[model samples]
Target: MTETLLLIGILALFGVGLYGMMILHNFIKLVIALQILTKTAVLAFVIAGEMNGQIQLGQSLALTVIVADTMVAVVGLALAVQVRRHFGTLDIRALSTLKR
Candidate 1:
């Protein structure tokens, strides 16, 4: 019962993240949304692994995801900073207008 509730909560988090990514135009917000989406998958895996009695497997997978996500976030933020320096705004709509 607890696991089911947790899963439902995670699903809601995923939905919120997806909505933010799709509807928000800020580059930083998009990055945060992506992180949230990634975290939901990690959490789902951890929860399933625990339920299956393979906690080690889940922990390892979650750790791997954390490391990879850290790298991605760093790179993404760097790119965002560069975009801001070059374009003067982090809005997706503003960046799209640069396609001349």
Candidate 2:
């Protein structure tokens, strides 16, 4: 049914995002992967709530998740900016060798 397909799509999104997180070297790509991962998780909950007919809980959780994801992404982006400012590059390999 449509629900099953939705589940499969969400799974595929999660898998791709996880793979992106592992393979991508750029900070922007990593952040995008993280966003994709978070979105897939939130989407699963929303779909589950819809399938089971529990409206409020799913909507609230999805909203909460969106807010939290925004906060985390903003903070992470700021940290990334700082790292780049100090290190002068966005490469993870170079970042790994940073003294501090």
Candidate 3:
């Protein structure tokens, strides 16, 4: 029962993240969506470990993911800030237009 609920939650997070990625144009929001997707993967790892009797491995993987995700968020936000300062906007469409 608990596992089922967790799986459902993971699916929900993934869907929300996917939707955000598809519909949002702001870099910060895109980063947040990526974070949500990463978290969903982490939660799935933990849950799989719990079910397979390898909780330690699952936890280690989740830790690694968290570290990587943190770096990604930091870099993404930094880029967003730089883009805003240089281009005067955070919209992805505007940035793309400037590229051409």
Expressed as tens digits, the lDDT of each residue in 1-100 for candidate 1 is: 9999999999999999999999988888889999999898889889989999999999899999988888888998998999999999998787775677
Backbone atom clashes (below 3 Å) for every candidate: 0, 0, 0
Q: Candidate 2 — what's its lDDT? A: 0.90
In lDDT terms, which candidate is top? Answer: 3
Model 2 error, position 4 (Å): 0.4
The residue-by-residue lDDT of candidate 3 on 30-82, one tens digit each, is: 99999999999899999999999999999999999999999999999999999
State, as a TM-score between 0 and 1, how close model 2 is to the true structure.
0.90
Estimate the TM-score of every prediction.
Answer: 0.90, 0.90, 0.93
* Model 3 regions lying over 4 Å from their true place: 97-99
Write down the lDDT that model 3 would get: 0.94
> lDDT of all the models against the reference?
0.90, 0.90, 0.94
Q: How far is 88's C-alpha from truth in model 2 (Å)?
A: 0.8
| Number of colliding residue pairs in model 2 | 0
Top TM-score hit: 3
**Candidate 1, pairs of clashing residues:** none
Considering TM-score, which of the candidate structures 1 and 2 is the better prediction for this target?
Answer: 1
- lDDT at 78, model 3: 98
Q: What is the descending lDDT order?
A: 3, 1, 2
